[model samples]
Target: MRSCIPNVLLVSLLSTSAVICSPAPSAPPSKGTTIPLTRRSVHKRSAAEWDEWAVRHREYVTKKYNGQVKSKRASGMNLLTDQDADSDYYGSVAIGTPAVSYNVILDTGSSDLWLASSSCSGCASSSGGGPTSAASNSIPLFDPASSSTFKNLTTPFAIQYASGQATGTLGQDTVQVAGFQVSDQTFGVCDTANGVLSSPLSGLMGLAWQSLASSKATPVWQTLAASGQWDSGVMGFFLTRFGNDSHAKELEPGGQFSMGYVNDSLYTGSIDYQNVPSDQVAYWTLPVTSLTVQGKSISLPTSGSNQYAAIDTGTTLIGGPSDLVQSLYSNIDGAQAGTGSWEGYWFYPCSTSVSSSISFGGPSWSISPDDFEHTQVDSSGTQCVGAFFEVNTGDNTPGWIVGDAFLKNVYTAFRYSPPSVGFASLSSTALGENGVDGIAPSATIGSPAAVVSSTGKASSNKNDATRSRGFSVQILALVWGAAGGLLLA
Candidate 1:
């Protein structure tokens, strides 16, 4: 029978995290001891299995730099922000049928843990669609009613993103992932949410610093390390889209999301760091060396607007005020303007003139020409498409933030211990090892151009059918194991 999750063979998983959901429960282990996850390093799982990993990591994404921005320091550099500080990053910790794992955003920012809940209310399923294939029907679910470990937490919940926002319940449950397991762990869940959300994602799990986590006893990452599940408290990630073409293609065989770092990765050699100002305790504000339009460097308002550039791993596009973006796009050859919508920013052109790039930090990396092209039918029955930025006439300082769109070229690193971040790039071979498969393997996007298009939006819609771990291991393990005990009772 056809199945959406083909290689997710560890066991039954229950959630289909299209836009939102979570659950809770607990069960005694079969052996009375936890089993560490087999995955800890990169490129270990096969292609299909890696895809399964990405599906589960959704709840664990976090913002690189988070905090309160004083208007005085609010320079032109767009910082990361969510209307609701608590729920900004999309990350999660989930207990699936086969196993419990950490599903977080492969963000450049910080990393931590948040789990999905058993009480999630999902979107209505299509009634007319073909019935679930036998394999598809086997996904598991986590039921908290029978488990004693599930506990509702007091942390208030909310998440705000430039793209959209998610609101839900917060609570603590048993969680095991990437070889770590902790009882009474805290996480957020949005059972029924209404906000502008990316179609590809269902729930988020934060992995940044402890500040982003709802769990009070221990930060998610530290908890994992304490459990002796991780090699170290350190977490490694290689985002697929930011690398060169050939390496990115190989990333598909490598699942878009997997734990641990790529082996022997390269860096710019220098580790440039700026501590987050106390006033902006949550976010690490970085200084802008300069601004450039195409290959030519341009003048900016300078002194006032250059204070902090919010490095966010959650966003797919780079966002900045219209005045700044206007000058930047003007320099890219073949770029034109188009209609604007929250669906996404629009640019003009038919045969996309790509390979152009916007440089930051200290490198002259090239932007792929093909990364910005799209084809749409004009009134003349001709197809038209181009770069991805739609000027938001409605708002200027509408949080002009840089997204993954711009950061992909740099070898981005997040150092949470000091609350600072670092950047560099990897070799071609390394890029091939870390991408595409982590996000979604079925997608065939090429560079920024393909991803920027509405087609990418449609592809993300399919995420709705993605499944949650079917049954709670802790719950089922105890229930089935106690059948003999029930008879004795």
Candidate 2:
């Protein structure tokens, strides 16, 4: 059942992480244009410290990495094994390829799946300071030339993010997810684009550690549903960033990715599958029970407004109505700073003392302390750190993105679209339909709270090739005209 619970306090939730695949090709980077961020006042730092600053001033890193931000979701087609020239990130079903390996982006927003074209010249848009090359660079791009399953939907797709857009072509391809490969799934091929490329990540394979996403697909969770594999239910993820030892904290080369829980960690409750408006321009609108500042409840303008919220996995931050943010910032001491803090975006006062936790929603779902205070500092010897994002779609802009900044803390589930419009997961995950456990927050990762709702039932748009990027709604006119022509004949 696609459900959206406002004011109803469901049980609190918890969380779960990882990446897996074949050996990657040795593709390296070809340098390109880069934008230098030089702030005499705030020096850049390392990933460690950045993690700290993440909790204090979220606007910092997202703004800092503004130029580097991009979007991707898990994507693939038929599970046939072959000798294809693909990398671990972009795997192929070939004799030489061995088995199924994928390239996916860990997202915390909307649930959707898609891929990039092996022939994507779109990556050429990088400004000289382009992506780091690797052996996989030689792998055949998502070339329609190699696969007969590729079908031109004649559709343009673009996911606009706070930093940039992941634009591409929407087509039907045989996709593989969670070991189950589908004959036809809606996938995207980035033919033209701008922004992103800090690493070799091209397509996003989302099962974010949040709800709602920066783009149309939302997250891999949604894409799988559209694909027939796991189409009956929403998916889940576990984000583990910690290490067994301090020295072991290095990012695994090429890394491992997954769609559901990996560890025994438990969750607290069910998923809130709020139905997004089917008009393509839809969003999740849940009620705000309250916004507490420094342990005190602050008032917001969200009351009675069909608060439009986007669950974004591609984003690391959470942004929305000023009132919601203001309340959150005020509760924490060093969470907000001056206009100079986030370059005037929004920030925690530099002098504000950091608080342990900030509460929200009705009394039913209360956000915890540690989850609200996660951060990653920078390499510089200064206070600059790695903070993800929290943004406004603009004044009266109808949608707000609640990103990983929120999801990394809790367990979340998305009930597939059918009898209802939602999903479920427990704060402990022990209560969900799946017997899997939720996340056990270590010194490594973030905490929880969720996109509260219950179920979702959405119509699959397989023949939606006309709904691609740049096409606008004019295709609908063409469809109508064709229908008229057929009638006249």
Candidate 3:
């Protein structure tokens, strides 16, 4: 889930002929580009704050899944406000004419693009000048009136979440990101945004398929793919970990987002690709073939629909069926399930090193032990919350929502041409301090062959071989702090 809800909202756009919006060359470049993501941190949360965020986060996940099932699309998204835990990653994108760049969350769970307008009602304000750090409680607003190419689509946009909502008007303008430009891109410009946006982060850019878009607008990525601008319809992510780093700063380099190719330096061995089921095309939904805890295989639901898991980069935690979650934790010593206010969660002794892994029709990828330990729960710091929580959608929605907890463990790639997801073992440098918990020495890392499609065919295209013709947007990862509050003016 994004820090903001995925509610329906509207925005307007203006045109620009700036250098950033220059036309693409006759031939598109083939090489993939990289974007840096920043990981922001906030002051250590009290037990109460953690509890509040957990409750709200659970509610948001429930609503997100339930809404998707009922509507055949994600109805709303839960965005983490500044007051919540700091776990989201952000990248910058320039919109409108003259190219005003704003920091937006790059999410794969939904489809839609929205930004705060200059006239936004409750949006947070930046401290003037550009943001110095991820925690810099600053946001740059987009003024449609300043762009000569701006055009109002006259569509009302609104999205509601468990915490807040953003409502505005839909419009079109040129959008530039990762060195690619999409002209007349449809997006939202909010006039009333409360709880939906946070400081230092102005908007969200959903990278899912168009069918999931609430505004019925083609996502910037899809637009790029349709225009043959992408060398390959592949985007990969390498999310870094900072929770356990004592020397970590409020704004620190997090990871990389690769467009059109995979960065071999980020991971080792060959990539394991899993095809997204045809019917489950809305999100990057894949079937979980198996799961294990402490080297013991845990029984999973045999029902096809119940085994699906959505690879969500925007979400900070891993959520699964209540029974499975309970069973997994039961394998850990001193693990206790929460009750009442803490229901749907699990807690364990801080000293326990929980080792777990999951598979998607390929080699099982190990999750780092550090990722399992979410945060310290008690004042004495003897107890800690488990990153894996219960997400009971009550319907035939994907049984798991795999977020950063699991994603940070591997180098993940999403392919559009064949609608598949791939996972590879992280390189030594990318793995850093938190190595794979209990991955067996015999575990196969696959072969460095072409990516396999869902139909069992090998993909011949090389994502990194060709270079894009124009300037590329390097997506860098940075750490940011949450806004003070969702102030409504």
Candidate 4:
């Protein structure tokens, strides 16, 4: 999402705070832990390039999941990354006995963890072909032959995305995150990959429940939960945003990923929890009560598919029905349909005010004006690309995917006990003085702020389903090198 599309053009930015309707529980993790996420180091690309990439990225995801693709809605939780270059995020995950180091994208949208294999075709070193992007060329490839602990599984693992597909053999290895390690974890080692799978990211780690895992094997978090890594199957994500002006820094901590522990210092006040609807449990899906633009509540059309929303950290932009997207953008001053290479993307006057917010059930989250003014469409910075896109999945189906465009605004939490999602304002300390914390001032979101668990006491009711691991919104926009050069701001 561009940094400057707030207001009608900015609804995607405010979307980051889509809170659930359920009340937050009282208890915080008594002994929470933090795993710092390092952003991928990026080669400088201009705002126009980023906007083009976002369009292709959105198209890739839409074609992969929506349309006639017909893939199961796998339940996966992503301790997703907030990419500084707006490409994607990666984290350190070790596999094998000697624990070979690899940086993988923390994707919540899809299941199955796959990596480039020593025998990969069309790979950078292979003859078939290799990565097309400059970013993908510098990535280190994985060689199963080097990992002593690797055991091949003939499960015929394969995954399809809008960009490309990863087809490889299944294998078991000891997967480690932070200090918690899950032995004999199943993963895919790609023998061949094309499309987006050829990126610089070494691999991907899926955090969703076991049900959504394509490997049909226990996911890393499930393995950790079974091993008593934490009290419950909870994953926390803290997504941070970097201003366009901060490009000079070699690296920035774009966000954080918490597996079994919560860091209380990352957020302010209490956390608001929302239940994941029974029907939409595969994803961290929730209901959107309303969408407010310029202080006016825009009515959502009820004629289409079942209304539901998925909190997808793997995505860079937001996706909605064509009618809703057109309606939302209609509120912007100079918004127009994309043309030529910018097709499927929305364009608007760069100087427009994106004063808007979205409501899940509780608080109305105002999109940041800076987030709306995402990137200048040209060197003049007079026009910007809008973050929201239209992905018409036809009628009589599910739609609406909220990605990083909206997620970077608040601290997000995912709980597996009852399968719910939660949102809270960024702690004042993290935001400093100028950062927009919590609900935006004067946006007039929803009713009074719901009660937050001040006691940090766990909920005693077994069926309450409100359990969470508290984490804040600070992350590294660059990779964590062996030398401690990791940046997490």
lDDT, each prediction: 0.32, 0.31, 0.64, 0.53
**TM-scores for every candidate against the unseen true structure:** 0.56, 0.53, 0.82, 0.74
Order candidates by TM-score, high to low: 3, 4, 1, 2
lDDT-superior candidate, 3 or 4: 3
TM-score, candidate number 1 = 0.56
**Which candidate has the top score in TM-score?**
3
Candidate 1 lDDT tens digits, 310-417:
565544445454556566667765555443221233444544444455433455445444334322325442333333343232111123344444444555544444
Better of 2 and 3 by lDDT: 3
Query: lDDT by residue for model 2 over 108-200, one digit each (tens)?
Result: 333445544555543422222332222234212355655666677767665433234456666655544332233444556665434332222
What candidate 1 gets wrong by more than 4 Å, as runs, is 1-116, 123-142, 146-148, 154-168, 194-202, 210-219, 222-234, 242-251, 254-262, 266-281, 301-307, 340-346, 350-366, 372-400, 433-489
Local accuracy of candidate 3 as per-residue lDDT tens digits, 301-418: 7675568898887677888988888889989889999876578989999998889999989999888788888877688988888988998764656879888888888999888878
Q: Evaluate candidate 3 by giving its C-alpha RMSD to the native, one decimal.
A: 8.8
lDDT of 4: 0.53
How far in Å is the alpha carbon of 467 misplaced in model 1?
A: 33
Runs off by more than 4 Å, candidate 4: 1-36, 40-55, 67-70, 73-87, 125-138, 195-200, 301-306, 394-398, 433-489
